[model samples]
Target chain A: MELDPKRYAGKRLLRREIPLSTTALREALQHQYFKQIPTLRKEKNILYCNRCNATQPHLQNINCQNCGSTHLYCRNCIQMGRVSYCEFFYEWAGPNPDWHIHNNPCAWEGELTKHQQIAADAIDQTMKQNGKLLVHAVCGAGKTEMLFQGIATSLQQGKRICLATPRADVVRELLPRFQQAFPTVTVQALYGGSPDKTGDGQLILATTHQLLRFYHAFDVLIIDEIDAFPFHADPMLHVASEKAKKQTCASIFLTATPRQKEKRQIAAKTLPHVFVPVRFHGQPLPVPASKLCFGLHKQLRKGTLPKGLLRWLHNRRNPTRQVLVFLPTVVLADRLQEEAIEVLLPFTQKILPKRETETLIRTVHAADKDREAKVQAFRNRETAIILTTTILERGVTFPSVDVAILDAAHDVFDEAALVQIAGRAGRSPADPTGEVVFFHEGRSDAMDKAVRAIQVMNRRAKRL
Target chain B: MNLCVGCGEAYTSRPSWSTFFWPERISLLCKDCEGSFHRLKDSGCPSCMKQIGSSICSDCLKWEKTSYQGVLEKNVSLYSYEPFMQDYIARWKYRGDYVLGKVFEVEFQKLYYQHFQDTKYEVVPIPLSAERMAERGFNQAGELAAFTRAKRKDVLGRKHGEKQSKRSRLHRLTAENPFQLLSEPPQYAVLIDDIYTTGTTLRHAAQVLQENGTDFVAAFTLIRG
Candidate 1:
């Protein structure tokens, strides 16, 4: 059976993923449009995976089960189909996908703020020039809206566009918004278990992990959350993003907090950038206040909320406002939830003498089975307080909620996480001054940097 | 930091008295991933180890009525083929994540010692057909057999046919035996496989060994569905 060239075009897929016999694959490769590359490239003693661009350390030698040979397979991308020495990654070396140029593709009716408009225009210019640009906007600066004009213009020019983020939740959240914004365009979202396997969409929204399946598939590759986990930390993800885009494609990085390397590049004027300090509502970012709790971990270990935390919860400026408590780890969050339900709930109930029914305090973590339901319950005001780990630090919003980070000095709560956690509050214009407090045993350098970063952004917003 | 082969998360093994001397014995799976696999209970059929209380299971009784009667003396499996094992097998075998097979090495070795240590049985992993071997790159049973210190003998050869996983139970039971003895059979033989679904594959291989004058044939599988 002959394989369809169109279906396989621009896709770097494993041999098993492609449904073609060896002879059929060989016949297809006879054409100038088809090509098959070795899955693992040997260099001296090291092996590199061509699919995920994983190198020596991420590749391990294994006894090949099917071939009975000792071969190196990529451990980095083992979650995807394992690519061993005997395996080959097939690709269609045909022409680039010809996208349909539609007129006025964007259906977004909302207007971008003046700050957003500037970044949008700069993004348009950068996309036109096939250049790199960093969109360092505040968390609530409407970063998605700022990309509409540039993306729409690119779509009108019949170019394929990709918006890759590090987190799957962000990909899910952006899918509907982008679909509504450009109803005429084909927008496909790709993640680990996503049903859409075809890489034929004109505009693809995917987690960075999904980018390994594409080879020169996009004309404009916009990476959202550039400094997020697994993206900034893994060199393989960076290589995947680079390999996913065309040689001359425009690469736009969107991040609220740029990493030190990117910051250095921007400062050195090697990379062009646009910074939007003020949010769409023109409000300053909420600066986190630090309160030193002498023995935070000791109190938490003893299964009791610290006095400073209990006092803060009791004396909240708006007692009706919901509270989000961020713990350093899941175990701590679970432990505190039990203590909060028993001790903190009744204490708050005493403060609110009129309310008779008890309020709900829930704990949520990445592995929580009912994480979506619990988060939805909090959104519906069914749950008054939520204790979570850094999983909820970004990509989620709740209106009029005070943020508190217990054990802020813990290495888990880095500068980016602290800023994003603080950003979670003050998102709604109706309550733009939500309180953010860092209840720590001793202030770490990350805590100090985060507080100073917020103040700097606020100061910049005032100058604007 | 050690990365779990089951779920690619960085984990640090807790320092215990065992680690104080043999610190190089790092675990390949995290606590949660290791806990997901369900071990089979001892209270099962004595023949095939299916959870049907003490006596021989119906499948074993039916196997006794066939021409290959009394071929398989006993079969012992380590896991119960739970939902987690399904996914684990899919990733390790079908997806070809070879390192994932290492996640079971220690446990499989312990199970092997418990069942087959006292006997002098020749370890023979169920061989894959040449086509399937070339396609999958390695036999899963072959990798599992390596966990034990026993020398594995490749004495049985399989014919190319449809995968047993894709076949219905009725078809599997009625299918022709695919095993051919490659050399003289050992007096005492133990067949190693990744799974024992209907036990037809093992029975067919055991029948070939028994026909070749092997005194006893026992099967050791990772999962018993």
Candidate 2:
């Protein structure tokens, strides 16, 4: 079988992932369309994987059963495919892909706000100059809409674009919206088990991990939720994003919470950035109010709810509003669900049926199989309260919901997480003043910093 | 700092009171990844360790009717072939992530010492054909055998054929034995493999060893499907 020249034009892939025989691949190499790169390169005594850019520490040697010799394989990217000493990674050395330029690609009818327009213009200018720009907008600030103008402008220049995010859920959510916004453009979403493994799309929306398969393929790259987990925690992903972009490509980072390093860069004027303090609905972010709950852990261990928490739940300002309780860990969230049921059973039985009361409370975490269905149930108002870990702290919007963070002193609730959790409330314009409370045994510095940051944003929004 | 082989998360080991008196056991997997592997209970079949009743399973009884019957004594496995173990085996064996075999080092050693401390049996790992070995790049059974500090013998050879995983259970049972004894058999032999699916492969190996003058033969596997 003959290999497609367009399919392997700009891809760096494993031999097994490509549906062609070794003879056909050799034929392509002989024709100067593809080149073979050593999977593992030796430097002195250390080894490096050319595919994943993994260093010496991430490589391990084992007795090879294939050649009956000792060989090294990269452990960092073994999940994708094993890159051993004897293997080679195939890279395209042929002509670049000819991207189709659309005259008027964007089909969106909505308009950006005043602040959003300023950020959008800056993004367009940055892309034209092949520079970097940071979009530091608050949650629900319509960040996606601001990218339409910049994306359309780049698409008109016949540039291949990719929008990468840290979380698969964010990529899943943004793919459809971008496809609708630019109906003429070929938009493909790439994740772990996504069907679109071919990199033929004009605009690709992918998780950061999927960028490892590309080799200088994108002319314009936009990374959303840049501070989310796995991406920020794993250095390999940073290398992947850098390797996926062309030498002179424009890079745009969109995030609601900038880590300390990015904050320093912005402060030093080393990185150009635009900040949008007000949400798209023209409402200030909800500032979390800290409440001292003495012996909170003891009460939970005793299978009883804290007095202050119980009183707050019973006397909610808006009884019809849904509630989200964030715990520090999955075990704590699950335990709280069990204990809250026994403690609140008497009160809930008087107001509702037993089955309805049971359905009113649920717990979800990162590992929960029914997390999507449960979150959907919460959005449908079938469940009144959702107890979860930090997985639901961002990228999910629930309108008219009050947020509470239990054990706010735990180390898991960092300043960025707290800000993102508090930002989840009051997302809709109809109920722009949802309550956010931090229930803790004692105030943590992260809690204080988060509250202060929200207040500063609110004050800045007032001036705007 | 130690990184989990399963999830690739960095974790710092905490020293406990037990660690002060005994040698510290290093953890290669995190708590969550480690917890996902379900250990086999003692209530399984006495011969093959399949989670059927406490008696000898029907698979083993059917094997008794064949020419290789009574050649294999018993088979003990560490984990049940649950979904987590299935995926783990795929990565470790098929994907050629050889370092993942180390994740079971400590537990595999502990189980080996607990079961075979009193007896002196030569550990002989089942061999892979030359073609399959050249393809996979590592013998999973050989790596598992290294976890045990006992004397290991590589005196078995296998012919190139279709993989057992691709064949149905009945087809596997009706197929000819692929094992070939390459040297003199030990007085007592313990065969090591990664998994015991239908016990046909192990029985063929045991039959070869038993016919070559081995007195007793038993199998030790990582998972029982």
Scored against the native two-chain complex, candidate 2 gets a DockQ of 0.67
Candidate 1 ranges beyond 4 A from true positions: A1-6, A20-27, A42-46, A343-360, A380-382, B1-91, B100-120, B126-136, B149-187, B194-215, B221-225
Interface DockQ per candidate: 0.47, 0.67
- lDDT, model 2: 0.85
The digit string of per-residue lDDT tens for model 1 on A258-295 reads 98999999999999999999988898998898888987
- For residues B89-121, what per-residue lDDT tens digits would candidate 1 score against the true structure? 998787777777877878888899888886577
Q: What's the distance in Å from true for residue A99, model 1? A: 0.6
What would the per-residue lDDT of candidate 2 be over residues A163-210, giving only the tens digit for each residue?
Answer: 998877677778789889999999999998787878679899999998
Best by DockQ: 2
lDDT of 1 at A156: 88
* Model 1 share of native interface contacts: 0.71
**Could you report the Cα RMSD, in angstroms, for every candidate shown?**
5.5, 4.5
- The residue pairs in collision within model 2 are A65-B137
